[model samples]
Target: MRSNIDGKRLVDRIRKYYKADDFQVSDDGLSVGKDFYGLNKIKRVEVRQLGWRENAVNIVSLALVLSAATWAFVPQFGLIALALTFVIGFSCWRKYELRAEFIGTDETGDHWVAIARGCTKEEYSVFKEVERTMRNQV
Candidate 1:
């Protein structure tokens, strides 16, 4: 478990790292970028790993490319299909990301918000730290 001071510092670092407009930590609670969740109101903080299904475009591109392999006899059509699939697949892969969600309940009802999204190691560490800090508070 991290000390309160360490947690606060971590939050500050994360806010700066993400270039969040307004992420502040206080005695009562902490604000996540734009949304603030009181300590008492927070129910859960978790990191959701994006699955293959979530990247539907990537899936479709992969399928198209694989099926296009069977159309090897059709030179022009096969080349076109492969080229299109390559472009789509590359774009989809570049945009792919995993996200961290903050789940809390208030007067209305339970709701969740994405606190962070990225595909880098540093960003992933930030997600884990945020989850740990929020979990400890709750």
Candidate 2:
């Protein structure tokens, strides 16, 4: 179930986050100090892929190691398996690019709202409405 979020409390929490070096509220709005998704500006899919891709690197390394072992531990070609795994892993990582600006709050101040880099005015207006309601509640 979804519910409305409080504004003063939200601002206070954001302040605390900024204080904790977890985030910072700037002229631009709230900036979670890092690239962490829970910091409030990234998508679930992007975050999920970031987590999964790192995991894939490890899994791929394991598989390559197993393959090398099956090949009688030939040292020369053993490095090839490792090298290819890393190359593939790096390419996959590249496709998971995230634009940090998309994760920030608006000038009107609504945290936890996710808007893409290029937003339509209509979308911004709707977000402002949500912010207005939340602020009014507090």
Candidate 3:
């Protein structure tokens, strides 16, 4: 696992990478970035899959693996035992963390940034500065 300080730095870097022009302030008093171009700028947009549901499927597969293990002691089930463990248990492990993100890679290439909440001059200065930096990098 990454250390807390490293995680924070990484988050800050991402924030800098995706600078935005305007936004609505969030409850946490942090200037969360908003994609002003709205839906038009977004392509290949998708929602996150339910991780809990995938986990449930994996658990069932694992249960089947255990059952196959026990039944292996009986007879022919032994050959299939190892196979089931590999197929079912592996599938369970493979589908653990499934998430979706708005990834845009068009003429501008892949870039994602957010404008900080608040239209104030100070906030815009900071937000614009970050956006400028990101755009320059592109």
Candidate 4:
């Protein structure tokens, strides 16, 4: 899982898509924004999909309450509430399902800054490649 990574090349590749000044790969570790994770301290690099299922109950409850409250006040506004609920639900679902996140976990916590979002399969492959390279470097 571990392989030596060319720090310069990796940094260049990342810079092609991410123009952030705070991100850099160094001999000591990877720097993303203000966070610095040591090469040996990074325990894992992974691509994770975040979904709304974890908050489904809360969303459903909110929708029901809003709809009921509006319906009690004005019948037409209830329709508006329903429409808003659908829009919010669809947006939340799409937001999580369509993008993949690249994360690096170290002793302190997880750092997400290696890739741009809205990641497709190709982007996912790139994330995996970065993960492999980082693992090897570790």
Clashes of each: 0, 1, 2, 2
Ranking by lDDT: 1, 4, 3, 2
* Candidate No. with top TM-score: 1
* Candidate 4 lDDT for residue 94: 21
Residue 84, candidate 4: alpha-carbon lDDT: 89
How do the residues 45-75 of candidate 1 rate in per-residue lDDT, one tens digit apiece? 6777666565666667695866578477676
Model 3, residue 18: distance off in Å is 22
Least lDDT summed over 10 consecutive residues: which range in candidate 3? 93-102
Instruction: List runs of model 3 lying over 4 Å from the truth.
Output: 1-49, 74-138
Q: Please tell me which model should have the higher lDDT, number 1 or number 4.
A: 1
Estimated TM-score per prediction? Answer: 0.45, 0.24, 0.22, 0.37
Q: What TM-score does prediction 4 earn?
A: 0.37
Clashing pairs in 2: 41-103
Any idea what lDDT model 4 has? 0.54
Which of the numbered candidates is closest to the native, going by highest lDDT?
Answer: 1
Candidate 1 minimal-lDDT segment of 10 residues: 93-102
Global lDDT scores for all candidate models: 0.59, 0.40, 0.43, 0.54
* Residue pairs that clash (backbone atoms under 3 angstroms), model 4: 2-136, 3-136
Candidates sorted on TM-score, descending: 1, 4, 2, 3
Model 1 vs. true fold: TM: 0.45
Give the per-residue lDDT digits (tens) of candidate 3, residues 36-131: 333334332221222556556766667676767667666666656656665664433321111112346557565633222322345445544544
